[model samples]
Target chain A: MDYKTVLTTCTYCGCGCNMYLEVMDGRITGTIPCKTSPINEGKLCIKGWNVHEFVQSPKRLTRPMLRKNGDLTEVTWDEALDFTASRIKSIKEKHGNDSIAFLTSAKVTNEENFLLQKFARAAVGTNNIDHCARL
Target chain B: MIEEIKKQVRELLTSGTIKGFLGLREIDGHIAPYLFCDAEDMDSMNLGDYKKPGDARYPLNRILIHLLSHYPDEILGVLVRGCDQRGLNGLYSLNQLDPEKVIPVGIPCPPELAEACECSRPYPENRAVDGQAEGYSNQTLARIAGLDIGKRFEYWMNEFARCIKCYGCRDICPMCICRECSLECGDLVGKGDIPPENPIFHLIRAVHMADRCVDCGLCAEACPADIPLRTLYKKVADIVKKEFDFQAGYQPDAKSPLNVLDQ
Candidate 1:
């Protein structure tokens, strides 16, 4: 009996069309484009219509992974972050700062992307930065 | 028109070519889609003149597609008019509808209905039913084309503002087949607000509809707010044909530009 449309921003791209995820019985059933919003005006392209598929997908990542013997093994955040930092430091030391590049994702928030670039420029000392959109 | 459609459905049911016939039925003084399984059930199959026949064009296409999706081998006969036929063609192009399994019973639209829909051609090119009237024309494109660009934009803005976001247009569209829609793409359109974004939701759809829309007026009918979405998409289709030298449903040999690689 949990039938309600939770208002949320579309995390897909930069246009930011307003919509509601229809939650029925705790299951994301469908989506409805917001009518009162000034941008989209209650119309959705094919993508907006099926925005809930990725959220309920089984393959979405929930935890960090570390590769050992060419196999990725799930690990704690502290272990994963420390491993990443040490690996990056070694890579910079061996190949110079120019060899390391930061590839960002569009799914992350603006603040996270900004932080990633800052880390790449300030900490990593590399201007070779790119985004997921290119690859 | 109602009586003629009923008689044809009755004949088709008795003809034994189809086990079930899908058409419109009267319910509580309104017309809604119904599946006439029994020949006697043709009594309830009401066509038009009931609740203004709000978007009856897409239901037959949906019913046929639904049947094909679940019962791929089963043969179901459908009552198709000009718009419905075009929709069927679009669906067939997308492989959503199986041409061999379903029988199309074409119905010629009357002059008044044609005028109401603002359709260019009211009769389907293919007809299985007998006594269908000649195709009629109501040139909505010419009128829209004659308008200035600014006026047209203002007109579309006002019309789109009345949208209720029921998604009846997308639900009823036969050509729109994607697990995820661009309109829903939060990347392009933001989430959580009424009226959504103005031209983004609609403009994105228009871009997607470039070579797909069959000039069926179901989107306009499905719009609870009576937005003239058909006119806008019709313009888009026109642009596609003008630029790409392509028209949907006119030729089975042709492929929609969106599906093919740019080369």
Candidate 2:
């Protein structure tokens, strides 16, 4: 019974097209391009139009997993963060700070990206920081 | 002219004749399709600035169909251009829409837009605002038709090669109403291939547009690849007209020859 359209911006690329995400009962049902948007003018790229598909995709990762006994096993956030920190520390120590690199995603916020680059340069002492959008 | 349409819409809403009026509304200097459920919303209703060339036009009929799917029995009033009226006729013939559940307020396209679209009839048959009809012409279709068989094959190959397999043209088309589209069939169209196997992708869509295309040109407008999709679909419409002596959306009750297998 709860049907509504939430206007938002597309996160796939730099174009930043606006669209309406049709939500029915809290589930993303479809994507409609914002016709009045100054950026897109009611037209959408393929990625912008299919933004809802990934939300409900069964294949999407819901929980963090780590390789244990040569298989991915569900792990708690504390265990996963500790594992990652320890691995990064070992790698940096063994092969120098310059050997470490960080790859960020476009899906995250600008603040999160700033923190990631900061972590790469300040924490890991490496300038090797890049984003997936570049690929 | 827009004032008259708004007045009629307000009357319809206030009299309880229609549950909702689907039309365009201007918000922050941008016009978009909106569902006006209350008489007070009529203050924002805009018939589009016809003086502005190349006005942003959305598929009002497509939005109407989506709304109708949710509220099947409720009567809704929709703003329609000539092409939109034709689309409604085609939908009605196909039994996709219940004629009694809808009302159309017609606004004819201006001469410049009519010529740009090359529309033969730029006004609906009933309750239409006055507008001159422009002769239909498809230079792209004519140019392609003039080419030799080998040249024609090369022309289409080059055109189809630029396709990014976005399916934007299909997604924007108002006449494409099926829940399960054949273009998505894995067997017919191979999976995970960008610019899907040249001729098949374009050909399959062209065939599907045979008796359904209303020459709205929205497909070409939506295509990011700049493919001549409207011309391709127009050719299909021409073929149906020539072969079956039937023009889609011209008559409400007329069934497409392809739909009538009893030929």
DockQ for the candidates, in order: 0.02, 0.40
Residue A53, candidate 1: alpha-carbon lDDT: 87
Candidate 1 has a DockQ of 0.02
Question: Which has the greatest lDDT?
Answer: 2
Residue range B31-81, candidate 2, lDDT tens digits = 666788788989988875533633667777877777788878789999887
Cα lDDT of model 1 by residue, B1-263, tens digit: 55666776677778877767767665444344556777787877655443243333335576466555655666778887877777777778788887887777777776667777666666777765554444444377778778899998888788778755656687757677888987778888888756878877888888888788877676765465777778778788888888888877766557787677876
The alpha-carbon lDDT assigned to residue B95 of candidate 1 equals 81
Model 1 chain A: which ten-residue window has the lowest total lDDT? A34-43
Tens digits of per-residue lDDT for model 2, A23-87: 65588877877766778777788898899998789998888899999999999999999999999
Q: What is residue A102's positional error in candidate 2, in angstroms? A: 1.5
**Per candidate, chain B TM-score?**
0.85, 0.94
Prediction 2 global C-alpha lDDT = 0.82
